[model samples]
Target chain A: MSAELKKALYNISALADLGQAITSESVFHEKIQSVFYVITGTFLANRGAILSYDKSADRLITVTQKGFPPADLDRVDPEKLMSLGKNEPFLIGDSPVLAIAGVKILAPLWVRDEFIGVLLLSGKLTGSPYTQEDLELLNVIAHQIAIALNNHSLFMDLSDKLEENRRLYEEMRHIYHGTLQAFAAAIDAKDAYTQNHSYRVAKYSTAIARELGWNEHDIEGMYVAGYLHDVGKLAISNDLLNKVTPFTPEERAEIRKHSTTSHNITSKIKFPWQNVQDMVWHHHERLDGCGYPEALAQESLSDGVRILSLADSFDAMTSQRPYRKKMDVQTAITELKKCLESQFDNKIMLVFCKVLEKEIKGELPEPDILPYLDRDSDLSVISSMLEAIIQELSAP
Target chain B: MKTVQFSVTSRLVGDAAVIYPKGYLNNLSGESLVKECGIYIGKGITKIVVNFSETDLINSIGISLLLQIIEDLKNIKGTICCTNMSKFLQDTFEMLGLIQYMVVFPVESDALQYLKVGKV
Candidate 1:
């Protein structure tokens, strides 16, 4: 190859390398400085500087420099600088200033149809005239620099969009969680003695699910269901819910209607929680065909509902109530063992037993007692609770 | 960004109140149309004739507001019959599942004919 062609090929390869750097995740200022250094150091021995427009101030400002005092330009006012709009390129030594004695080339930076800035190359300190080849190369470099700047701007825009989407998803998730909590509270409020039952059920269900090697997503779904399983109880009469004596068969059937009620209630809300609705509907269902509502058999029910059913039964048996003195934790385990296939999913029952054993050993916090031992339906309390929760969520 | 404009006028037909509406149906016009329908509902005008002779555009917001009107009027056994609709608007109404609740007529007289027969 001819020497001139080889030199041209080398310059092309160097330019491509610079383009790659600008495209990479390198820091913004470093890329700008590298472009300034490469263009001025390789193309000429003259002092060089780059100026970009300050859109807010409507003036050109120096960005990067080579062989020039980088800080001195800062003290100069923008309006006093030579106008470099469009195709206008002003020479440095147009005045008789000593600093610009033999200055020569001035290349304006442009990309697309808009003029972004200019490239100012002054006289060579060793007394040299900038050749046509040098000017050509400098012009090409300035064009590439403009392209790089635009690319960086786009990257910044995409970065901002990603940040905005992340913030939106986070805020939506928070609102969803708060809504679920309020629904759980409403259910608890319906039955005075069952106030904190949902919270404990959620804790136990989440523990058993984690021990069973479920993924974090499934465990989270189970957590929501455990807290909201009795949501349908909102439709039941408060007197029926807190009855001091055992229910008649007809009253028992009326009580069982809450499962379907809860299902219908949850299905109306838009949430990524289909399993929560199923668990609420089927938590009373037995492995055998004796469960109320649809009486879904073991084979038809989801694994989540099966696990929740076991947790719900265990918690009810151990909890102290008007009808039955609290069963010993050991007795509850034995009862769970006796009715595994008949009333509960056997695998889930076994996990429940293990979780109970761990609890008895004090491996975790003692199960919380139910609240709302006293009843109050004053409008002020409910309104204040809702307002406090909403304020916490909307805080800056 | 499209503009939809319409007017609601009432005609006396036997013992029923017939309402006539015209204009494009988009975001800008859908709100006013819905509000006017509510006023008609207050006046005990349960039967309606919506004339679309001058309308050419309907967006999702317009369709949603029309659905709201249908739901609101359903409890009173009130009916809205759409007439003088262009072929394009008829197709759009069908695509949005609005035809199931509101009857469609090829011309104003056809809708009035149905009202005479109590078939609306």
Candidate 2:
């Protein structure tokens, strides 16, 4: 074979190898850097830089550079140099890009029909201008670089869309909580005395969690549990929830189902982090396992369930209801202590007591539990027993 | 958030159906409203007025439900408007672009009249 034919065949083989390498690469900077490496190595050029055109800003964006100062990249007019004929490699010192002293040639890069950018090449160590064969090889490689850049751009667009969708999904999950809150508000609308009761329960539970030094994530989880604890009441009627008269056996059974309903409702939310669904479901459970719905015992319950139980009891006791008036602070505290062994967790009640103490000492308008004592016919006995205990604890 | 007397009442004044939703308009209440409106629509009633005089609070979930009702009414080329909106809900309606599509009157009669004869 003729020497020219042999060199032509070798260039075609090298171009094919470099094309595979460029297309397989994903990172923009690294891919373009590889392009420059192949170009300079084949042509024996000491320095080279690739600049992709920014159609929006009408500027040449420097993608990669080797052995060249970046400062002069600003002075290189990529638009002016992009369409040069194959034989015309701009010489050194003619343009500001090659004017960087030792720099030599600038080859305009094209792909298909469009002008993509310019490839600036400096002098080889052998001290010779680019030969005809060298220029032909470099142009073919430039075509490969364009395909690589196009592939990289497409990959980036797809990646950005995926990220945007992920962000939207995260935002939608938060909005679901707001939707449930709205549902809670609608439920609250059924009665004036019970208004904001769930919100207050959540607030109280969060406070107790904070007092216990729980992490922010767990505190938020507790808040969700408290908020949804009474949500199952949505299935019952306003008449049933606010019935002044005592409920019949069937009505009472339906009313007692609210806790399980709340749990099921919260469970459907599917939160990304730790969920309070089970906690809300089990909020009505007692330590002695005499509570309603599933009647889960202490062993199956979590700290969140126990915390919600205390918070819900405190708010219900202190708040005014259709059948009962509000309870005084002292009386409510007594009731909470009395229920400790049967209804609530001691550890949770201890933290809640601190919250109550802060409000009492600060003279805050905490829920008035005094009227609740008047409504509960048997509360006076527990009240006196709690009062005696409080006096003993205060003696210290 | 609770309005004890919370209820959604419906009545017919000639060709226009008027719905008075009392209390907080959140998701649960919204579900009821959607069912009520769906009934009125199924009965071939189109022109409607939603009186919010008794409603004191509304949330995004409620707004989304309202959106559904509005979209359904619009599909039939039927007119629906609201009346007696609180100051906060008025702002909410404005921000959510609900005001541009539906006329909001400060009086129930005005909403009724607009729905009945297409006048503000």
Q: Each candidate's iRMS in angstroms?
A: 29.8, 30.9
Most accurate candidate by lDDT: 2
- lDDT per residue for candidate 1 within A1-396, as digits (tens), equals 554564465456446545654665657776676565445434433356777756567666777664456555444344433345433344545543214323366666667766566666665433446556555666667677767766665677799999999999889878877887888888888777776678778877887787678998888889888888888888888888888999999899898898898889878866565577888888988889789699887788888888888778777876766667766554665677677678877667555545544443456565322121122333344334434433443356
Task: At residue A65, give the lDDT of candidate 1.
Answer: 64
Which consecutive 10 residues in model 1 chain A have the weakest lDDT in total? A368-377
Query: For candidate 2, what's the TM-score of chain A, rounded to 2 decimals?
Result: 0.61
For all candidates in order, the CA lDDT equals 0.65, 0.70
RMSD of 1: 31.1
User: Per-residue lDDT of B1-120 in model 1, one digit per residue for the tens?
Assistant: 654356556566764545555665533335567677788788787876667776665543355456557756776898888877777667655543457778888777788778778654
> Candidate 2 residues B15-102, lDDT tens each?
8888888777643435678788888998999888898888866654465457657767877988888888898778666543467668
Give the clashing residue pairs of candidate 1, or none.
Answer: A103-A123, A232-A262, B5-B23, B6-B22
lDDT of 1 at A341: 77
